[model samples]
Target: MNQQLIAFLAYLSPSLFVITALTSWYQAGLRPTAVKKLGMISSFFGILSSLILAYAVYQQDLIEISTFSIYGLGLSLRLDTVSMLMFSMIAILSFVIMRYSLNYLDGDHRQGTFLGRLAATIVSVQFLVLSGNLAVLLASWILTSLCLHRLLVFYKKRPGAIIAAKKKSIVARLADISLLIGFVLLYQIFGTGNLEIIFQNVREGISPLLATATIFIALAALLKSAQFPTHGWLLEVMETPTPVSSLLHAGLLNAGPFLIIRLAFIMEATSTASTLLIILGAFTAIYGSVVYLTQTSIKTALGYSSIAHMGFSLMVCGLGVYPAAMLHLIAHSFYKAHSFLSSGSVIDLIRAAKVTGAKRIGNPFKIILGILLAIAMYSSFAYLWGVDIQNEFQLFVIGGIIVLGLSRLFSFALDSNASIKLWFQALVLSAVVALAFFSLESIFHFFLMGNVPELTIPSLSEVILMSTVLTLFGLVVFIQIFSPILNQKSSFQALAVHIRNGLYINVVFDRIVRAHYHKEDSNSRIVLEEAEIGKYILDSKENNNEEQEERLA
Candidate 1:
């Protein structure tokens, strides 16, 4: 295989997708059959070309194809391990999504336009991932945001869709501004915008401006990944078509963690920025997870779960475990995409099954046994893998959490089983989960061998932060285990109401944003039903009182 040909194929793949999409939108706008065929053909070429390129890159080590230059910076595309992985993922996922939309929007008039925008979005992300320079990366990032915004407002008449797009636009622009600032700072310090040069400089020595630039980069990532107050946009964007939601949650939203990993060397040099990432990421993780459990709408619940996953990914990057973050990114993308696409069947499944209430079964002995198994399993694996526990305590903690979750799963399965064969099956399932996780991590670690820097001994502050995170993880698990018992008490219902309302955070932000900027059509049917938090709380209390009166009668 010629290396040049391989590189050309890689570029040609996404180019084909873009060209076909534009042609379909422009020429076959009214012909659904023609549009669908073109989409399928384009995606087929994309997957084939990406796979070929990935194989070539793996055989050839790394390839940088420079096309042009401005001042000292080159407009270039690189095919390294990280870029190859991302390119392949984009190709495969786009193919799946495009195939799905053929049936999903079979008769929709604007199906051609939807497919075009979807292809454009994927192409933009591919460019962002393949970028070898800061200038190219920033341009690709902006393009991706614009393409996704068009997909988000597929139904222009829906007020919720419009408002969500508006909110997302505001946050994306803020993120862009932060990224621009970081770029300027890096150029000023390193004297070039080339990523290779910048990274090399980072390895050789730290710059005085690196800390400030890294902080700006982290800020951009936080906004892009929908952290905290800015996350309302993600939840509200559910009015878009299901395929669009799948792409947004699973693909585009991962840019934050990817950006952080791309600059791992810089992050490793700046402890302050890393610490800030830890704090912000930890808070968002816990916040999103809590809200996820309270949602009734399946899509909205999935949105919160995406937030939690992204937050946890960012936290992993902060821990200097960039390989683990990459694995998380890839795994979450596939899982969330499938989850969103198949979410329509959830109601059917639930209606067909028995409505079992949460059981009050808290066995202390089992819990203790599970915790011990987790410790033993993870510790043994770490030892076998020769992981440096003295410096990488964060990895150990994460491994323990993973194993602990699996242990609980096995315990639940065993508790319900009556036969010895069933118990054996549960243990086998637990082992399989552990083995799969380790296998995936090992592959990513191999690809990322040189990317991550060796960590020094943990500082006192980092130790305290890690301890805090462990405590929070334990707290979340404890709540999950015991919340059913507390739910039966009258006093806990108020707390439940607040939790279900997302603690009124999004409600307050929604009102302020809409009051200031939203200009909705008077006759639009889309209403902000969840915006009136106070009314909801009051109504819940009145309903409770009525239920009590009826019971007394």
Candidate 2:
């Protein structure tokens, strides 16, 4: 097929899935077993199409098309390595989640609607990623958010789901509005909505106003990614079905960090705007990690972890380490999706084992997994030290400390028989090992060239001494905190509450919104009540009048 036809087919797959879902809904009376099967099939094809598009884009280097015009603005779509990567990932994951959902959401009343929305969402996300210009991106973003809102509240009778959907809708609207404004500002300043042109303009030196507008664009990205203060919607989003959570939190949530990285490449690297992104990214990382440590519910914990991982990706972007960030992003999507899927299985196992009066013990493999993860994580941090001794080392130390503390907390919080505890620990250890090995290798490579930079931390001996001291300090702090919280109800409750409330940050934001919008419409409320009463009264009065008229006649 020609490149244009191939790209068009790839883009249409999601829409085709949606159409198939609707057909299944019609034919199967909304309880369609066929709908689930067909949806999965369509999604599978979508993934295949996306893969083909990825290959085509790789061959072509770049592809662009003017998709449509909206409100007099041209909506363009483009494919590059970044967009193709995201598209392929989304397609693959969406397919998996759809297949999983067949069994997971079996017999659900709104199954057909859910499948349709899921298809639409997948399609919307594909367009959003492929959007070449701000206008296309914003339009697709709004549609994606809308579809997600519908999926979130698929169980409309569930009060929690309803509330969550409302919250998500509000936050999404805020993001959409901010993005629209940013786009308009950009167009005004840059004279085009083309991303390539905007980047060229920025690189050549953009106006202060345009730079500030770009910050607004970043703000929208942050909101979408669930960064601090604006992160409440994501946590509440757990009310959605598990598959939806897997797709949104694990797969699609990376869009924000992806956007930042893309824009970072376009903008002047040393601009204050870029520096602000770095600070925000770092703060998000720290905040998310700390908050995640406090969470109890498995899904909530993963949500916070997602935030932290995204923050880490953003930090890498801040440091102009785009390649590393991309690597991390890919790794995270796979691991996180696997973790969330496995969590559901774990919950089921725990319940079934409980029925048999058997103590559900930790999975032996999980402990090994945790150790491996810890090693990898620490090793990666060490590699960062080779890049910039001072900054990277400090980040590594901070990240290590956070991981250690978090692992301890997880170990303590889990029931003795719970397998997750072992898994968590193994993963942590594995990460540490991996990071350490990579960092050390990088260091060795740097030295072998005999072009080693002056040892900022002194010598190998001093490096060892400093690492040991930091490790000891971290251990001390971990013990101090861990000891007091040892199986205490109050401590556990405090932690659980903090985790449940997501550090009460969402609550605070809620209060601020409520306080400012406190003018209740008493008249409108009463009018509605009175209108109902009047309806009954008027009906009674009309009946009497009719009866009296009949008697008189």
Candidate 3:
């Protein structure tokens, strides 16, 4: 990939998406087939370009398209390893989602409008990832949220959709303001908004101003990622079409982690921001994972699952393991998109059986066996990779989490006779999984070696935070595996109620939204209904009067 070719592809890629969006919006008269065809063509080209860029564009292949060069203080689009990685992920997922929508929304009235908004959302995300200018990045951030809001309210008549969209808008605006504050602080600290300049200027001993900016930036990431207290909107947004849900869960929600990764220099430099991310991100992960198990709806459960995944990703970032966090996100996006799109098939498969609520009666001995095996497997991989607790504590802790989660699979091995063969088979499977996991981790780390910060030993506080998070994750796993026994307890049942309601945070949000916006919605509907009734009465009276006069004559 030469410079001219790389530049051409970069320009062509974004142009394709933008052109498709404008044409779709222009032909918003429900020309579903044409819109679908256009979307496919553009996405195909986009995927190709992005894939090429991902492979060819490296750390030094920095390309910038500046709007204007006025004292080196203008907005520009950037193309580097980070941006290229994001470009590849989003482009590939966008293609999958658009292709799915063509069939999912066949012959729908507003399909064109939905596809148009979807394309626009894609465009916003592309610019956001490619932005070298922090100002342009923030603007793209705002645009992404606005476009997604429009998609959320595609079914305008649904009250749930309207309310969800409203809450999302409110939260998104606050996040935007928080990020804007951070951006202003950055300009003050470095005297420039150009990201390359800022990165070049950042040092180990950052100033008070830069540290303060990290807190605000971290806050914005939390809000944008749909962390707890504001995560209800994500669960309640099932009123949109499935394709919309797929994109929202898979791509758009990743903006938060992406933001943190983009500002890794500052974020990892400050203990305050890192602590905030670890504590809250880990808490939300637990909260969401618990709530996810309690939900009856598949989509709602998946929504909560996304919350958990994003929380964990941010937590990993907080640990200063940027490569692992990035890998987690990319893998999760693919898994979640597939999970959502195939959700209906789950119902179909189970509908044939007259099934009741089945419980997992776990064997304590087996669970313990699985845990030991998981630990051994993780240790084996860690040793092979030359990763130790002293130097790469972050990866070590992350591997612990992975193995802990993997232990749950042992509960489903289905061997009632306590056979050795089953245990051997499970052990083999764990090794394979561990091998694949470390291989991908190594690749991502290679690509991101110079792009992100190097791993360092944690402080006491950071060590405690990691231990607490690990304990919480272990507790979650225990509860899941022992639910049959745990459910029998009164205290367990009580906790379930609270967790199911999201600890009532969303209830407070609902009250606030209803108090402010419910009246306008009700008044307009009432007024329209009253006008229709009045017109009907007037027509009836005129007909009656004419009939009586004709009879008299």
Cα RMSD for candidate 2? 11.0
Per-model TM-score versus the true fold: 0.89, 0.71, 0.89
lDDT of 1 by residue, 119-219 (tens): 78988998999988888899998998999999988988666898889889988999999999998999999888788778888889988899999999999
Report the lDDT tens digits of candidate 2 across residue range 1-553: 4966865765577667767657655744346666776787778777787878877776776777776756436867777777777777877788888888777867876677677778778778878878888877888888888888878887654545765666667777787887788788878877787877776667577576776676777777777777777776677776678888888876678877777655654433234554555567666776677667666688888888998788767655544445455566767888888888789787778778845322423443433344344445555555555546564553454455545654443433342454655556645665555565355444433422211111223345434543654466455544433433443567666766665566778888767554223255867756775887889899999999999999999
Candidate 3 C-alpha lDDT tens digits along 29-140: 5666666777898788888988777667653567766766554467687787778888888888889998988888777877788888888898888888888888788989
Best-to-worst ranking by lDDT: 3, 1, 2
The parts of candidate 1 lying over 4 Å away from their true place are 1-3, 355-358, 410-426, 454-456, 515-553
Weakest ten-residue segment in model 1 by summed lDDT: 522-531
Best prediction by lDDT: 3
State the lDDT at 325 in candidate 3.
89
Which structure is stronger by lDDT: 2 or 3? 3
